[model samples]
Target chain A: MQYDFEEILETIKMTEIEHFDIRTVTLGISLRDCVDRNIEVTKQKIYDKILKYGKNHVKYASQIERQYGIKIANKRVSITPASIPFDSFKLDEFVEVARVLDKAAAEIGIDYLAGYSALVQKGMTNGERELIKSIPIALSETQRVCSSINVASTKAGINMDAVLMMSDVIKETAERTKDKDSIGCAKLVVFCNVPEDNPFVAGAFHGVSEPEVVLNVGISGPGVVLDAIKSAGKIDLQQLAEVIKKTVFKITRAGELIGREVASKHGIPFGIVDISLAPTPAPGDSIGDILKAMGVEDVGAPGTTAALAMLNDSVKKAGLMASSSVGGMSGAFIPVSEDQAMIDAVERGNLSLEKLEAMTSVCSVGLDMIAIPGDTPSTTIAGIIADECAIGIINDKTTSARLIPAYGKKLGDYIDYGGLLGKAPIMDVRNLSSNNFVGRGGRIPAPVRSLTN
Target chain B: MFISYFGKLKGKKVKLSESEIRAIAMQAINELGDNANPELVKEVVEKAIKNSEYVPIPETQSQTTGRVILTSFGLNHPGIVSNVTKVLSDANCDITDLSQKLMGDFYTMIIMLDISNSPKDLSEIQNDLNVVAEKMKIKVYLQHEDLFRFMHRV
Candidate 1:
């Protein structure tokens, strides 16, 4: 036999028992050429291009899923940032573009279409400012379009003005979709040093430098890693890291194979395989469980950051060895709502917003999928965004805030969107003001590390 | 003989006649004009040859090994293997290897098959096996062999 009996069984066990699966196979279609002087023409071109490349995206992905036994969780699309090519559009025009994107996504039968975005890590162009202003209305009106704004980078410093505006935008989006428990906010991300080829939606965009069309895959299997840890009981930290690297290498290889096959089917270029340990809400498929298995009592425990740092490092090391094309946020994600164990930790008061912020410094992304009181002031949100940006800039890693200030929801309440977005408990926030600091509204100059070049 | 000689010159198995080769040279000359050096002429000739003979092979041809691993397990029954093999034979699938083990009253069987020559694709064969498994109250999983090789091998 070409494969050992145990090897065959292990492959089956990963898919059937552990929740090992490709998190997303995002088809990135560039809309750089879709711009036109007329807003209607621009919308039509965007819709047509997406349809031409993406009409069979879900079909091809499902076929590949069946061919292999591994399930692909999401078949999504990302486009060139709207504010880039269509820089002449106003707020209303951008909103119109978002609606057309929603229609195209629905037509092609994908759940989310990202890249309704602007990258203003330095300063905003007039169109970028207008597009940022239109996010609340666009998100409120469209069911499947997701928006992100890059407000800071290590080289460009923190764009304090953009951060402040995004804070207000997040608040307004939360209020606009308050009827659905601020679901609009759930579809928005404020990023620092966001990756262009990221396959995960809500933060994914077809970076300007990316090719006309590409396929990137995000692989998630925290359950597989957790199982490996549980089975490797009593091993020291170094030995445990070996176990994680071995398990992640196998999964990342499988992810790359699947990604290449899908890209071949689309007749497009395969981009990258993001080896992030993204957890779903499914039982036993939680990153928090992995941390617990690493001997942390709960997520907010004192040793949590160390454990996450080791886990994130081990994942990256293994991914690098397994696939040469590892990009995006290639570490562990700790989204509060998307992982069941993390939600349980927050509810039990074992995890706090502050601890999540700390954990983000060592992990893939920052303060993801967290719900706070609706009345939490925009300045406070700006403060949180700035703190995350500070960590990202100093460390020179990608950090983002997908915060849902659940409108009219307070502490002890929950915002449940169910199925992948899962549910987030509204956690307590400090009432301390940042009015004077954020009100200054100037770029935080690039840190000393930016002098590396 | 002429086609093979020309194919050997280009280092590709693409068939071309003497007249076809002359036409390609003529086209390259017309395209490149006076700037054409020997290296540039060779490059244009190769591209023209590729364009003339390109058939756009289906994406699946290069990726698929056409080998699949079919694993089925359920409570021990009288004709479990027969029913599964019947479907494979009907689909023109060539079973390369087979193994089975029975622990107590439950049986697990793994079959390696080369379905390259099959009239039906993997999905259709899977659907056919699914029907058989449903009738027999067994669980069947058909996956491409590359998945296992990629995961288990380096």
Candidate 2:
């Protein structure tokens, strides 16, 4: 007997009681080499590389999951940002590349393929402008392809121009996929301080600096932490934080072990283990529930921010201790549609869009999975991205938005996507216009904090 | 017949229930790992009566928590249950309930474990058991009780 019985049981308890799982095992490949002047050659090269890696990664990930009895929610792929490698392509030509990525992803038998992306924190290059412009068509035309754009960062100021443009792109994407609850918007994330090695999509991409190929993991277990908090029974905040910190260590250790094993078996270098408290729509598997367990009466209440900050910092501390290669957005994710508690709170009118924005300042992301009225001004959407990106830049944290403008749907209407993506109610937005704020189409200078370097 | 777990080199042997004898022996082997000295192990096994965990409690399981069924098959040898339970217990899995069979040279075991209080994780325990199973030439598999019910239910 190498291990005690109790340790084995705790792991089982997490999955059984709380619906704990490895959210994603994304294998990132540098598509930089897939670049070619000829579009056909480029598309073929990308397809071949993706198919080759996809087969092995998925096979090995499923094997690991079966062998260890840990459920993996998704096996995904992230490639080098398309804007860089296919920089010479026309605006519409980039859509063909996206089609190739989508087909390759499906052929590889993966859930999603990310990196239909661009980095325009400071400015957009000619190819990046083409990529950004092609985003709507690419997203609307491809089922498994996810798109992301980094419009702000700590070192780079927020690109209000890109922010404004994405608002329109998102609008078109929503309209194009209106039949499926504007699902195209669901696959697009506007990011500030995006991670290169993120295993989670709609925001995953192999950054310019990543290796030729690597494996990254995203570990999620909000239910396990909530159970511990419940067992602690009205403990003080300090004690609750301590409890979260300890539990996170076990989860992160499990994640690192799984990630390293998969990487070792596939002969790909291990990237990072992102131990985030990402919630699904499942009952009892909610961070909002954890907030309640921590004595916050409502998820979006006054104390919610403090509770989230504690949870986020505690996870990071535990993850840092558990794995030296911790990266990506490793904190509590407050995606509205994906979390049942959040959806309930919003539908019940207790969680307002304003409160959600405030909460996102402390979370790993900003205003994620939120659905707004179809007629809400794209300027307002731009304003939201700008504000969220400003928070990321000034506070030096990762923040993103995956907002859906439910076409022809307004406040109080609900749309369900079933399973993991879950359901979201159309949230009301401030009626007043932010056209002037968004009109200032220039870099919102890097914050003073950026001068630390 | 239960082994005398409290018997030393020069002391009157004290009888221990079957569960007590098994718990202490497993505990010693679990701690010593592969470096365990046979004579020292026997001596510690006899002196393990002082351990509170060695004191058997009435079979009671909390109704709120469910269990997992752990199965192992191997060439028949001594201490199959002892060795398996030792590793599981050391991993903090509670051996609340168990059943075993030895037919010919093949041994089979099924253990009901409540993992709610485990200090380590399931994957780590699996890896450890895998190492031990390979060394002892056994095949081990685990499934949640609900999964077993769904699979075999009419």
Please name the candidate that would achieve the greatest DockQ relative to the true structure.
1
The TM-score leader among the candidates is: 1
Off by over 4 Å in 1: A450-453, B1-63
Clashes per candidate (backbone, < 3 Å): 0, 23
lDDT of 2 by residue, A1-453 (tens): 322345445655776667888899999999998888888999999999988777777888876776456788889999999999999899878999999998898887887899999999989889999999998889888999999999999998898999999999999999999899999999999999988888899999999999989999999999989998999897787888899988888788777777876887776689999989889888888999998888888887789889888988898898888779899889999988899888888877889988888888888878799999999999999998988998899888889989999998998897778888999999999899999989989888888854565
DockQ of 2: 0.02
Model 1, A161-236: lDDT tens digits are 9999999999999999999999999899999999999999999999999999999999999999999999999999
lDDT of 2: 0.83
Clashing pairs in 1: none
The local lDDT score (0 to 100) that residue A96 gets in candidate 2 is 93
